[model samples]
Target: MKQVKINRLSDETSAQLQLLTIKDMMSLLCISRPKVYELMQNEGLPFMRMGRSLRFYAASVQRWLIEHEQVRG
Candidate 1:
């Protein structure tokens, strides 16, 4: 798994930190690489294009998760 050193901080502080790679997203979101790419297409997922590489803002991704969260009980 890729290394994603997220700060175990308050919500206010969480948004001030790093970006994540596709591999990192795989681990963080507990999803597959294909799923991440799907979200990038079908969903308005934020990303940064660095040459041929794709990067995502960690904070934005967390917020995306929060907004897309579903609960099943």
Candidate 2:
């Protein structure tokens, strides 16, 4: 298993440090597989390639969501 170095956060947040698979990413973002790939390729979604598989850090993905979130008027 590949290891990811995570910055220390609050206890609750730190506990969530783990790698997420593509399926997990799809579910977490509530999007389709193709869309996830699109985001990874074009939308700057953070990810790492582990051999032939793609992995995402849970906390990083959450932070990305927060950073990318837009307040629609």
Candidate 3:
């Protein structure tokens, strides 16, 4: 008998593994379309260029947001 290992992902991990489109980013960040492009260019928002289309990973975007968050004293 052979034993195989199974890899499992938590619910939160699975949710964070999604690829977000421009419209998805706009809705998620509540920003305009142009703003999304500006962030990708100037703000160093993590993304991948697939042909002519841009794709953002949910986890990377969340991480970027957290890194850029400003705290008011």
Pick the TM-score winner: 3
Q: Give lDDT per model, in order.
A: 0.86, 0.89, 0.94
Residue-pair clashes, model 1: 0
Q: Is candidate 1 or candidate 3 better by TM-score?
A: 3
Worst 10 residues of 3 by lDDT: 9-18
TM per candidate comes to 0.72, 0.76, 0.78
* Model 3: how far residue 29 lies from native, Å: 0.7
| Candidate 1 regions with alpha-carbon error over 4 angstroms | 1-15
- lDDT tens digits by residue: candidate 2, 1-73: 9999977688776656688999999898799999999998998999999999999989889889999999999
Q: Model 2's lDDT to the true fold?
A: 0.89
Instruction: Go through the candidates in order and give the C-alpha RMSD of each one to the true structure.
Output: 9.7, 7.9, 2.9
Clashing pairs in 3: none
Q: What alpha-carbon RMSD in Å does predicted model 1 have with respect to the real structure?
A: 9.7
TM-score, structure 2 vs. true: 0.76
Report how far residue 3 has shifted in candidate 1, in Å: 36
Candidate ranking under lDDT, highest first, comes to 3, 2, 1
Candidates ranked, most accurate by TM-score first = 3, 2, 1
Roughly what TM-score does model 1 have, to 2 decimal places?
0.72
